[model samples]
Target: MNDAGPSSSHPRCDQIAVIGAGAWGTALAAAAARAGRNVRLYARRRQTADEINTTRRNDAYLGPLALPDEITAVTAMDDAVRGADAVLLVVPSSAIRETARDLENCVPRNVPVVICAKGVEPGSGLLLCDVVAEEMPDQTIAVLSGPTFADEVAADMPTSVCIASSPVPGEPVGEGTAAQLALALSAGSFRAYVSDDPVGVEIGGAMKNVIAIACGISRGAGFRSNMTAALITRGLAEMTMLATALGGRAETVAGLSGLGDLTLTCSSEQSRNLRFGLQLGAGTSRQEAFGGAPVIVEGVRNAVSVTDLARKHGLSLPICEAVRAIVHDHADIGTTLGDLWAQPLEFESNAHDTTFRHPDANMARERIEELIG
Candidate 1:
C-alpha cells in the first residue's frame, strides 16, 4: 500500500493525531484516512503499533478490518501530536486526564483536541473537557459523541455523531475549530453535526451508558416493552434535569448525543453495558460478567459518577440512582426495578428545565472559567 497524503481533489486537511489504539480510535483513524486526511494513531504499546503498521490491521481491537494506507500507528506521543492539525483523544474516560496531561508541553499550540471518549470523571464529577482543561489549560477542546459502534463505523456503515465545542454563548458557529474538524472528519457514511453544547453532549454520552444497563436489566428480568419505554422516557427526563442544572440546553440532549444515543444503546445487545447488565439480571457476579471480556464496560464505572453528579447538582435521578444501586451497592436487579416504580409519583417535567427558565449565563460562564482555571 502507498503512504501518500490525501488526494489533491479536496482541500489540504489537517494531519489528525488519534491518541488511542482501541476499537473506537482505530475506526476514527480509518474514517479520517478514508476522508483523505493524513492520520496517525498512537498506541501505548510498541507491539500494537507494529501490528498495525506491518499488517495494516488492528485485529486486536477492530478485528480483521484493513486500515487505510494514509494512516500510520506510532508508539511515541510526540510523533502523534507534533505538527498535527487536530488530536482525537479516544482513550477511556478513566485515562483521559493522564493521557491529556502527557500532551501538555507536546501538543501544538492552539491545535484542538477532540474528545472521542464518553464519560464523566469518577470522583470529581467533572466532564471530560473540564478534566482536560484542568490538565491542559491552553488546549482547545471539542467533543465527538453519539450512537456509534466502532465496528459499524469501521465497516463504513451510516453513522452520525454530534461534535460539540465551547462556543461563545449565543453565538452561531461559523469558522470554529470544532466545525472545521467536523467538516474534515465527515467521511463516507459517517456524518458529524456541530453544536456549542459540549456539556449536554458529554452528559448524554456518559449517562446513556448507565441507562443502557438499566434497559438490559429490565430485559433480562423479563420486563415488558412498555416498561422499557417508560425507562427510556423517564431516563431522558432525569438526564435533561442533570444537564440543565449543569448549564446545558435540554434540546441538546434531545439531539444525537442524547435521545439518539440512549435509544441505540438501550435497545441493542451489542452494547457492553447492556450485556453486563444482562448478566447481572441473570444472577451473574460482576467479576464473572467482566472476567473474560476484552473491552472495558464503561457504564459500570459511570454509574457511580453519574449518581454523584446528580447528587452534586441536588437533582433527583431515579434511573441513575437505581443503576448505581444495582452496580455498586449489589442490590438485586429485581428489587431495584421494584424500587424505581415504587417511588412516589411527581411531576414528570423537571423544575429547572433548560427549555424554559434558563440559568444565569454570566454565572455559568464564570463557573466554567473557574473550573478550567
Candidate 2:
C-alpha cells in the first residue's frame, strides 16, 4: 500500500486560534495567517499580547517581522477560541492538561484541538492527546509532530510532520481528524504526513529531547563520531522500549517523528533542547543556562517529566533519568556521562531502540560551545 497518503488540495479554513506566544506558537500563528486564515494568536501574558498587536512583531521570541494584517493577537481565551474553527495548543507539555481543562467550555464542540505540543505526562505516562481526551472527551483531537524547529518552520523553511487523528472512531490508525487538519495546514514549504499511530508520534517527539541532551554532553566531552552514533543507537533502544510499553507502534518511531527529529535536534546547535545541555557541559548552572529569556527547550523540563513517567510505569529510561538527575537533582555531570557510557552491551540490538544521533556530533561540540558563549 502507498504510505504517503492522498494529496492535500482543499482550501484552507477562515480562522485558527493558536494558544501560547512562544516562538513555536508565534511561528504557527504566522503559518496559519499565511494559510489564508484570520489568525488569532493568544498569549497568557497581557504584555506579550499587546506587543504582537501594537508592534507587529513577536520581538521577545520570533524577532522582528510584520505579522500579516490577517493575524491578530489576544490574551482572552474565550474571545480567541470561541468562534475559531480549530485551536492549536502550542503551550508546553506541562501546561497541556491545564490549558485544555480551561478551554473545555470555551471552544466549540466540533472544533478540532490540534495538539502542537509534545511529551508524555511524566509520572502518568500520558501523551498530550490522551490528556486532552480525558479532559475534553467530546472534542476532536489531532497530533502534529516531526522534525520541526520553530525558527525554521516560522521562516517557512522546508519541513514535515506527522498528523495523527482518529479518522473514524472505530477504524484503525490513519483514519481521523489528524490527517484532515494536516491537509488543511499544508503549504508549499510546510508538509504534513499522516500517521495512524499517535502514540508513536508523541513518543518520538518527547524522547528525542532526552537523546538530544545526551548528544550535547557527548559533544562537550570530546567524544568521537562513533561514540555519538553508538549513543544515538542506544537512545533509540530506550525510546522504543518506552513507547512500546506505552502501547505505540515501533515502526512509527523509525519515521519522521522518530529518527528524523532525533537527528535534527541532536546534531544542530540551532535546537534549543540540545543547546541547553551543551551549555551545562561547558559549566553553566541550570538557571544560567535557561536564564530568564524564553526558549522552547523541551529537554529542559522533559528531563524531569520523562524520569518521573518512567518510574511510574516501572520502565527503564536510563538516559532520560540521567538527564533529569543532572539537571534537576544536581547529579554530577561527569558521573552521569560516565554512567551512560557504562551500560552493559547487548548483541543484536533492537532495531526499535535505534536513537539516530548524528555521527559528526563530537566535532560539533565546539560550535555548540561557541553558541553558548
Candidate 3:
C-alpha cells in the first residue's frame, strides 16, 4: 500500500465517496459496499439522506437495491467525502465541474477522483476529465463509464464498464486503484476493464448521450431498423469526430465506452434520452417531456452542448442540430426533417476529409470558430 494517488503505493481500502444521491449514485454505492468496502453516499437532500440511513433503501430512484449495512448515506458532502481513498462523482455532466469544485474543499487533496458521469459541458464543450482536471489539477482522475442502467446494475445484472486513467511512466496500474475500483464495481454479473485512456473514456461516455438521442428519435418516429442502424452509424461518425477533436484515442470510441454504451442506451426505452426522444417521435414537445420528469435527463442537455460544440468546431452534426432546433428553436418539425434528410451529398465520400469546402463557407467559418476556439 502507498499514497492514495491514482498510481500511489498507499494501501487503499473500501473507504469510498459517492457524490450523488440519485439512482445511479445509490446503486453504485450499494455495489461498492456489497464488494466489502465502507462507502459514504452523499445525498443533496437531507430527507433522502435520512431515508437511506434509516431504511437502507433508495426507493425513489434506484428501486432494486437494499443498501448494505456498510454503506452510509449523508447530506453533507464533507461527511461523505472525508478521508476517502477514492471518490465517485455521479452528478450530471453539466454539473461535474461545479460539483468537483465544491467537493474540492471537502476531500483529501491526493485522493483519486473517478468521474462516473457521462456527458459534455454546455458552456464549454470540454469532456468530464477536462472538467475534473480543471478543478483538481494535481489529483489523480479517472473515468468510469459504459452502458450501465441503474436498475439493472442494482439487481446485479451483467454489466461491463471501463475504468480508465491517464498513462504515467513506471505506473504499475496492477492491483491498485484499478483493482480496488474493479472490485468495487464488479459483482454478481458486472465486469470492469481497466484502461489508461481517460480522454477516450470520458469522450465516449459523453458523446454517446448525443448519439442515443438520435437513435431514440429514429425509433420514436417509427422508423425501421434500417434507419435506426444508419443513425447509429452516422452517430458513431459524429462521436468519432468530437472525440478526436478533444484529443481522445480514435479506437476508444469503438470500444465499450463508445459503441457498446451507444448500442445499449440508444436501443432501450429505459434510457432517459431515448425515452425523451420517443416522446418527441410520438409528437410531444421537448418542454412537455422535460417538465414531467423529476430527474435531469443528461442527453437532452447534451444536445445543446454537442450541437453548440459542433457548430463552434464547424463539425456538421445534422442530427444533433436538428434535436436542438426541435428542443429549443420553434422550427417546424416537417421542415426541419426535410432540411436534415435532404441535406445535399458532398462529392467526397471520405469522412476523414475534415476540411471539406462547404457550399456555405461563411457558416462553416462560424462553426469552425465555435469548435476550435
- Which of the numbered candidates is closest to the native, going by highest lDDT? 1
State in Å the error of residue 121, model 2. 2.2
Listed in order, each prediction's TM-score against the native is 0.89, 0.84, 0.86
Model 1 residue runs over 4 Å out of place are 1-13, 169-172, 290-295, 351-373
Better model by TM-score: candidate 1 vs candidate 3: 1
lDDT of each: 0.84, 0.78, 0.76
Query: What lDDT score goes with residue 64 in model 2?
Result: 73
Per-residue lDDT for 30 in model 3? Answer: 76
TM-score of 3: 0.86
State the lDDT of candidate 2 residue by residue for 1-373, as single tens digits. 8464533443234679999888889988887776677888888898898888888788878787667667788888888896787899999898999999999998877788889887878667678898999999888888888888787777788988888775566543333566556756787688888877888888889889988987786676565577678667777877777788777888988889888888888888888877887777777777777675665677877777776776777877777887888878898766666555444444446554445444555435445344434
Over 4 Å off in model 3, which ranges?
1-10, 175-180, 346-373
Candidates, ranked, lDDT: 1, 2, 3
Deviation in angstroms for 194 in model 3?
1.1
Residues 80-161 of candidate 1: C-alpha lDDT, one tens digit per residue:
9888888999999999999989999898657888999999998999999999999998778999999999999988899999
In model 1, what are the clashing residue pairs, if there are any? none
Q: CA lDDT of 101 in candidate 2? A: 97
Candidate 3 local lDDT, 1-373, one digit each (tens): 6543343354565698999988888878877877777899998898888988888888889763677888888888888888787999998776788899998777666678999998778787777778888887677787898888898777767888888877767656564555557756676677888777777777778767766776676566666687678778777777777777767777888899988998988888888888887777667777777567665777778888877877787778777787778767756555555465555555333454544344665554354233323
lDDT of 3 at 348: 34
